[model samples]
Target: MTRRWTDAALTAVAPTTWGTTYLVTAELLPADRPLWSGAIRALPAGLLLLALTRRRPHGVWWGRAALLGALNIGAFFPLLFVAAYRLPGGTAAVLGAAQPLLVAVLTVALLRDRPGRPALLAALAAPAGVALVVLRPGAGLDPLGVAAGLAGTAAMAAGLVLTRRWGRPPGVGTLAATSWQLVAGGLLIVPVAAAVEGAPPAPDGPALLGYAWLGLAGTALAYALWFRGAARLPVTRVSVLGALSPLTAATLGWLVLGQALSPTQLTGFAVAVAAMVFGQLPDRAARGRRADQPARGQRVGRPAPGRQVEQQAHGRHVGQPARRRLVGQPARGRLVGQPVRRRLVGQPARSRRQASAGASAATPSGSAPGGSSAAAASGSVNRCAADGAAA
Candidate 1:
């Protein structure tokens, strides 16, 4: 449990560092080159990680790595930049806030997992809290930007779920897997950046510093930690941590840019924090309910102790052998090899008594004159019937 929270905190660092992207781009990076900027951020980090890991994907992992890269970084980064450029920052953030909810739905559809009630509520509450923190009055809504933002959110959400689903290939570390994705995603973006933005701009010292931070810490380290947690933790839980991005952005604006926060923003901050924290907690009720369930292939209930012998005797419970009579003992109310004798329905009582006396007199010693065993078996059957009646 402690390890789970640790992984969550480590994973959270990715988005928290991401919160600084707006500030970094506005203050440090070259202007009017968002595509080139994304390419720089991804390509160098990926190359650096590849150099360090010295491992490559094999077989199906090659295709899997490309798909994950496209969703997580290649397509997502371009769409995100488009949204940020075309829409108001507030509106873009509010749209991106829908990621947790998207992840929840996709988890059910793709992974067949039902998130707990708390997780579902958190998914709804996270977007509302983010809207409060980042949304502004009369924020302009561009159709293209809205579409891009939603697409980016969906892409990232799908990437997150798929990351959890596929996980790291055998014997490959998180760093290696992250490197594969970054490299694949970076390679994909290079052509688009070159086509759209023409040549890369010469970076000044501050721009170089900014690129290094975004590449090494933001892209490489951040994604490595993110994938590690995704492999170890629930996807919904990890996606909820994305709410921290806007909250962190808002905080940086206040501290670094001298922006002031209103009471409503502060309230929203508290609510977002509360929702993220609540989402992290283990669902004890869900765990308890799962614990109460019977394991697969197990019987639901056991027979009563008193009925076990009878059931076993009839080959009903454990398929034991049928009950056997003891030597010289009778079954039911008759000797083992003898036919049952019955009196006529309307026979007189006196006649019945006389017949019984005659049979007993013939076996005075409780044994027939020539067939002692038959007489003994008959006596035993009669005793057994009387005992059964008493019982």
Candidate 2:
């Protein structure tokens, strides 16, 4: 019901859905069809969303959408699939784990967001945890696949930062924004998918089901939630959730495939989960930080407008520089027989204090401060001080 809880729920959905992707790809989808797989996954989901929402991107948004698609979806998907296909799932997950660090750097460049201590710690901890959860000591990598995986992670990170930077257009809902990127990404995938993988032969039931699931759940729903979180939350917080994908994939393998989880694997998973929780903690201290701090040109402790006006009035009437006033010094108001001479806005108190001391010392203790002999003769002790003040 609350916004924070709603955003947390939405944030969880993005990476949790992504976790199922690797398992879905290896188990259910057609093999050796990365480009085609990407196209099929993105295009149909995008088209369906567009049709349902009845919204098309306008003006430069068309190009912007295409660019985001290319980064987040088109270029990212095929590369991701290639890595997943070539590397063992664990190795692929480790490579994907690098995304949070990449996002931290990109946030600085794109969003101008300097990662705080927690963000930096989370960035380091997340990948280490993922490595523990997924990367086995014996796990090996392919050169090209390793390159593809790292590249895809970087692209995804950049896209995440950019999504936060260039948020959705006015009046466009999350579904519409997701559709635009998906469509653009899908279109980019099409020609490549055609040239490289071509059309798929008629699929049996399982493959068809896999494709349907990948499109509807993975691309459509996952991206909808991902982009929504990116638009609403800090990019680092959104990307930190990426750690869940590997954790999910590893857990599923243990659960569904009946793989025995060694103690080390369990430890790793626990560490990753801990890191994920820490990463999601709200960095509330950083908010409103810039406001209390003044700009470079701003004067520190500057007087208010009315105070300045009062200073100006004093300057005009008294025939003295405003600097004669000292803001912190005791008031000069009606010192028993001396007219006021204290400054209220500028200059050091040392000079004024010395002058006051000289004036005080020169007068006799029996007389008032103004040293009026007539007030001394009056002999009314209270009125003597008052009469000398008037004199």
Top candidate on lDDT is: 1
Write down the lDDT that model 1 would get: 0.80
Q: Each candidate's lDDT (Cα)?
A: 0.80, 0.78
Candidate 2, residues 149-202: lDDT per residue as tens digits? 999999899888888888988999999989989999999988988888868546
Q: Candidate 1 at 264: error in angstroms?
A: 0.4
Instruction: List runs of model 2 lying over 4 Å from the truth.
Output: 284-391
TM-scores of all predicted structures: 0.77, 0.74
Candidate 2 shows a clash count of 3
Cα RMSD for candidates in order: 11.7, 10.1
TM-score of 2: 0.74
Q: Give the 10-residue window scoring lowest on summed lDDT in candidate 2.
A: 382-391
Off by over 4 Å in 1: 302-391
Model 2 gets an lDDT of 0.78
Clashes of each: 0, 3
RMSD versus native structure for model 2: 10.1
